[model samples]
Target: MATPRIDLTAAAMLLGLAAVWGGSFVFAEIALRELGPMTITLHRVGWAAPLLFVLVRLKRLALPRGWRIWGSYLVMGALNNAIPFTLIFWGQTALEGGLASILNATTAVFGAVVAGLLLRDEPLLPRKLIGAALGVLGVAVVVGADALGTLSLRNLAQLAVLAAALSYALASVWARVRLGDQPPLVNAFGMIAGSTVLMIPAALWSDGLPDLGLAPVTWAALAGLSLLSTVLAYLLYFAILRRAGAANLTLVTLLIPPFAIFLGWLVLGEALPASAWIGFAVIALGLLVTDGRAARALAARYFLHTVTKE
Candidate 1:
């Protein structure tokens, strides 16, 4: 059998996924202007849930067999979607849009570290450690050194954003262990379901039905977030996960910062400071190192020779 080469379809899907997630921050900001964090989060979860359910049913995607998988999916949904979604919205409510994005970029570093600790087979390598450390340093730079000492509620809110990333990292590792074998659509559907159930009470108590008096722009942003960012982006993500594995798919976080920064500039007229650009570059480099593509090539060469000799 021949070794499989990466197809263009997968590449395009991944790119689209990255772009959607990157641009999500901008939409989140727009939505936040008129809606509370809980309200916006509910829109994302509630709308996407039914839409994804319809899509899953149309595709006839069956979930994995047994309660263990369903139970795990419920937990994964909370960690990956409900909690982080709410946290980022709340964090962004107090923080600058660009600053919140910079904080969200920490997801990859947290994912790598968490995966190493929680996963038995995926041990931490020296290179990955160095890469993750560099990525953290870049995040600090991107957020601007001046913002660190604000000593106000916003600072704490930014920390909450970081905490959300940490939770997502844990969720990623947990998903691999518990739900990796299930079809991508099934897993995605389960997550949307779980998030909907979890967010209902919070949305009702906090927002009490989205203030229908909001401007059309706010409604448009909410729609974009639910349909494009939450539903479509996740579909592409799950597709990539099925083809590429979670470890590889997760590396897209490295690409998200630059894309998010660019979108912020384009959509929101936000200016990127020099430090943020530098931080973006460093984070990208760190992700490349952690992915271990070069190591894989070298290993392939060594293994090929041994096999030939045998």
Candidate 2:
């Protein structure tokens, strides 16, 4: 039996999800200027909760009724959302925003490794191995050669951010292996609820109430972060994961740096350093190599569709 064609709309939706999520790093940077990492993460999880709950009620989707599902929610919630989100926010405090965004791209490399190591269904294939290698090289280029010396406490913080990326990558694979059949909202609520529970005391200890008195610009940034980056991003992400395989969905990270750098240039008036431009080119090349799209196009031109002599 012939396999049916994949839904192009679904692929486009997944791509849109990727673009929105790519902006999250910039949003985090904006929120961190006015709010501590814990505070920023707290507001996002807490504010989104009630809204997500209401969404569940409106959709008539039951909360995970079983402990098994609940446990999945808790574990996934922490790994997928809370811990990593907080790490990236704090790490960015010390690192250059662009460099931080570039480092975060390592999630694709980590995802491939994690999926290959843990998931029986997703063994490491030649393409995956090549893709993973290119991704790592891309990340290296994006971080620049000089930043290697900056690794210390700040470097450790950057690693923590990368760890967060790894956690997110692992969570994607884990959810597919474990919660593939669970509702998207359930997975979302789990992470949001778990992150909220974890952020409470941390928020209190890190900083007192975030100053709402900041310029309207700050408030606007906060709203943008919470709504577009956090709330909507999560929902769109899991929806994509549900439709496309996790492996396919995780490639979104590859494109994140470009969009992030573009937003930074447009909104923050930041110029892309020469190194950043070179890094961007390297990363783009790596993605092409990793996916074999370049090779595939060549094969189609020279080999695959060519007519043979009768």
Candidate 3:
């Protein structure tokens, strides 16, 4: 099958989605001041799930029914939302949001590896291997050689965020194979619903009930995280996935780091080290290589024209 081309509209939506997702790191940081990681993760999905169901109803879309579909939703929720959200929120407690976002960008690298293993259509290509290697090297650079030598909690937290990224990669592969035919909104709703179901009990067990006397800013941050990042971002995500192929959608990962860093700096006065910036560039290069756009462009510019002229 031919890949879908990303038109200008889809490109715009992709960028918008990247910005929303990137901003989530900043919001998570703000909300973490008052709420526990479990509470934040629970509220994120709990609030977004009902709103998404409302979207499903208003659009008159059929809700995916049956135990099998709900079972898939439960798995997706665990992979995509519950695990990642909790880990990321907990990691952000120790790491800066910008750094967390850079680590999160590794999702594509992991996704490439996961897809190559799981999907018959996406075999492990040479370029992908190189890209994945570069990405891992970039991560090492970001974490610094010294920190890696020690078993510090900070290092553990960073690893947790990367683990979350891997979970997202696995979830993406699962969705492609199992739930590709479902409507994007329906999938979004179902996954969030499943996340809510899983998170509520976990939050109660871990954090107990959330404090009702929390400050307004924390509440606002929670709302922003749930409404803007979780709900609206997924809608845009599925829309872009429909119009553009997954390769094009992966470009959003490249766009996220800058936005995240900038928002963290602007909002929280957080600054990244020079090494983190260098590592981020390397990761971006890996993403470009993995996406095949750099090679394609070179071919179009140099090889294709020469061959066609002959």
TM-score of each: 0.86, 0.84, 0.95
Ranking by TM-score: 3, 1, 2
Ranking by lDDT: 3, 1, 2
Tens digit of lDDT per residue, candidate 1, span 232-289? Answer: 9987887786676666676677667667778888888887678767887777777767
lDDT (10s digit) by residue, model 2, range 171-277: 87868877778678866776688778888888888897666677676666667767887778877776666676654665676667777777777776666567656
lDDT of each: 0.80, 0.72, 0.91
Q: Give the Cα error of residue 95 in candidate 3, in Å.
A: 0.4
User: Where does candidate 3 have its weakest 10-residue lDDT segment?
Assistant: 241-250
Best by lDDT: 3
C-alpha lDDT of residue 78 in model 3: 95
What candidate 3 gets wrong by more than 4 Å, as runs, is 1-3, 305-310
Select the stronger candidate by lDDT from 1 and 2.
1
TM-score of 3: 0.95
